[model samples]
Target: MQNTVTIGKQAEQYAYQLLLQQGLQIIEQNWYCRQGEIDLIAQTNDTLIFIEVRYRTRSDYGNGAESVHYHKRRKIISCARYYIHTHPAVEKCMIRFDVFSMSRDSAGEFSSHWIQDAFQT
Candidate 1:
C-alpha cells in the first residue's frame, strides 16, 4: 500500500498537470504556514488561486471534492490569508479558492474534477 504522503503527492501532481493544461502558472506547491497548508498556488491573468487537491481510491464515502468540508474550507481560507499577508506581490491580486479531485473507478482508472471558486472567504 502507498503511504499517505506518497498518495498525496501523486494526487497533487495530477492536479498540477490539470492546472497547467488550463493555462495557470504555478507559483508554489505545498505552501505551508502556521494556519495550515495550501496544496497548490497558481496565477491566471490578474488572479491568484489557492487550490486544494484531494484524491480517493474509492468513492464509497464521497467524492474527493466533497471531502473538503466547512472546517477544511476555513483552514484553507486562513492559510490563504496568511499567504497573502506574507507575500506582498500577491496582495493586490484577486484571490480564488479552487478544488481539484481525482477518484478511481472499479476499473482502476482515475477521473478528475475541477471546481473553480469552490468556496469563499
Candidate 2:
C-alpha cells in the first residue's frame, strides 16, 4: 500500500486504541454509508461516538483537525443519521462527534490531540 494510505490506517488504529484506553468500548471501526465514512464508532456509557481520525506528517497546509472541512462534516452528519436509522439498537443512545488529530515529528514520534465533542449541529 502507499505510505499515505498506510499512515491513515495506522493513525486510525492508534485513535481507536486510544479511545479504548480512555474507557470507550469499540462498537465499530471504519463505518460507512452512502453519505460518508466514519473512522471509528464507539460507545462510552450512554454516549455513542462517531469519530473522525486525521493525521499529517507535518502541518504544512494545515493541522489534521483543520482538514475536516464543511463538506466532510455534512457528509459525516448525514452518515450518522443513516447509521442511526438502520441500527435501532443505537437509536436511543446519545450521539456525539469526536475528532482525533495526529502529527509526527521528524523521527516519527506521534503527537495526538483528542477533541471530545469536537463539533455539533
Candidate 2: worst 10 consecutive residues by lDDT?
103-112
CA RMSD per model (angstroms): 1.2, 1.4
Q: Residue 16 CA error for candidate 2 (Å)?
A: 1.1
9-83: candidate 2 lDDT, tens digit per residue: 888888888888999998889988788798988998888999999998768789888899898888888999999
Deviation in angstroms for 116 in model 1?
0.5
**Candidate 1, pairs of clashing residues:** none
> Residue 8 error for model 1, in Å?
1.6
Give stretches of model 2 more than 4 Å off: none
Which ten residues in a row are the worst by lDDT in model 1?
A: 102-111
lDDT of each: 0.91, 0.88
Candidate 2, residue 5: how far the Cα is off, in Å: 0.3
Q: Residue 47, candidate 2: how far off, in angstroms?
A: 0.5
lDDT of 2: 0.88
Model 1, 1-121: lDDT tens per residue?
7787887788789889879989999999999999999999999999999999999877788988899999999999999999999999899999999999887677766678999999999
Residue 121 lDDT, candidate 2, scale 0-100: 61
